[model samples]
Target: MTRAFLGLGSNLGDRMGYLKDAVAAMDDCVAVSGIYETDPVGGPDQGRYLNVVAELDTSRSARDLLELCQMLEAAAERVRDVRWGPRTLDVDVLWVDGETVDEPDLVVPHPRMFERAFVMVPLGELAPDLAEGWSDPANGDCRRLGDWDELVPPASEGIS
Candidate 1:
């Protein structure tokens, strides 16, 4: 199985709820970083986002992972009305087994993972070795809210 790093964020209805649901829907979640709250970086003005990074051991391809991300986002009622617009959920396939991917619909190592504090901070928590030496883009302020277990509810308490 490939160890894929996924970046998750929510700013719309039940922000934490969306995140918890996404996690529970995953195949095998090995670890989850603490939650970080940050301001939106681009697109139209929007609410602050609750963000976290999850490491998954999965038997899925990059394309499959991308599809899963979209599925989870759709489950959260995500809309693409505007670029980087507000949404109930945002799931990004940051990296897959440290492999680089270049495709029309997806990009590995996330084209801008290093540029966003929201992604870097939580990611650093779960994989410090991977996060090292990367400069923060300073696009927006990112601060830790709490651990995933402490911030988000267990699946039993969330959606079925």
Candidate 2:
């Protein structure tokens, strides 16, 4: 099984519920990072987002994972009406077992990971090994919410 990292965020209604539901739908291949509430990053005026990073052990290819993430977003009623607009859910593939994939539709290790604290903080919690060499010299605002175990449900909870 390849290790994959996913970035999830929600700013619309029932943000935490959307996250819980998405994880529940992923079966047993996923483990989530601590959830952090963050300020809006860009695009437009919007609500703060509850963000988390997830680690997955799966046989799915990078492209397939991207598709699956989109499906999860759709299940949460995510819409693309405006760039960086509010959404029920947003899932992004952050890394895939040290593989670097560059394609028209997907990029591994996510092109913007280092620049976003919301992504880095939770990611650092779930897989610090993967985040070892990555750093943002200017990062000063990101704070750890808590331990990953304290943030996500226990593995025995089985997603829901």
Candidate 3:
């Protein structure tokens, strides 16, 4: 199994709900960083985003992981109308250990992960070593909201 990281973000309706559902949908998801709320970085002006980095241990190939990302986004009903536009849920395959993939629609080690504070800040919480030696970009405000368990209650928590 390989250790992989995925970045998740939502800026539209039910942002936190979308995130919680995405996390639950991931296969072999081992750990998740604290959630962060950050201002929109690009595209037309939009609301802030709730972001988190999820860790997974899986035997799936990078392409499969990409497919899983797309599946999760679709489950959240994500719409791709504009580049870098606001989204209900965005799942990015940030990194996959000992693996590299370069294609027209996919790239491993996400081309711009290091350049965004929204990605690095939460990522650092999950994997500090990987996040080391990276300079965060001055895009906009990004702050930790809470940890996974703190922010997303257990599915059965409120049940009788």
Candidate 4:
């Protein structure tokens, strides 16, 4: 299985639940970073977001993974009416096995991930050394939360 990195975020209803649900639906969840609350990126003024970086083991192709992400978004009632709009869930295929995928719809290594604290902060949790080197714009105030399980309890906790 390929080790893939996914950036998960939610700014709408049941933010943490939506993220956990999306994580539950995936395969081989290796590690999930602590949560971080941050301001919106490119959308209209909206609520802060609960975000994390999820490292997973998957055999699916990059394109397939993109589809899976979209499916999760739809299930979360994501609306694309606005660019970078508030969402119930936002799952971006950040990086997959250090490979570069530049499809018409998806971009691996997430083109602008380095410019956003929301992605870098939690990413630092999973991989400190690398996340430390990553430089973001420092505009958004990303606050680290307490515990990963507490903020987003595992399904085994009966948090379905």
TM-score of each: 0.93, 0.86, 0.97, 0.90
TM-score, predicted candidate 2 vs. hidden true structure: 0.86
lDDT of 3 at 98: 92
Candidate of highest TM-score: 3
The clash count of every prediction, one per candidate, is 0, 0, 0, 0
The global C-alpha lDDT for each of the candidates, from Candidate 1 onward, is: 0.89, 0.82, 0.91, 0.84
The alpha-carbon lDDT assigned to residue 14 of candidate 2 equals 95
lDDT of 1 by residue, 78-131 (tens): 989999899999999998875788988899979999899999889988888878
How far residue 128's Cα lies from its native spot in candidate 3, in Å, is 1.1
lDDT of 2 by residue, 1-160 (tens): 8888888899999998888788777764567877788877777999988888878888888898898899999899888999988999999989888588999889887998888888987888778886787777656355556655576665578655
Give me the candidate number with maximum lDDT.
Answer: 3
Residue 25 in model 3: lDDT: 86
Clash pairs, candidate 3, are none
Ranking by TM-score: 3, 1, 4, 2
Of 1 and 4, the candidate ahead on lDDT is 1
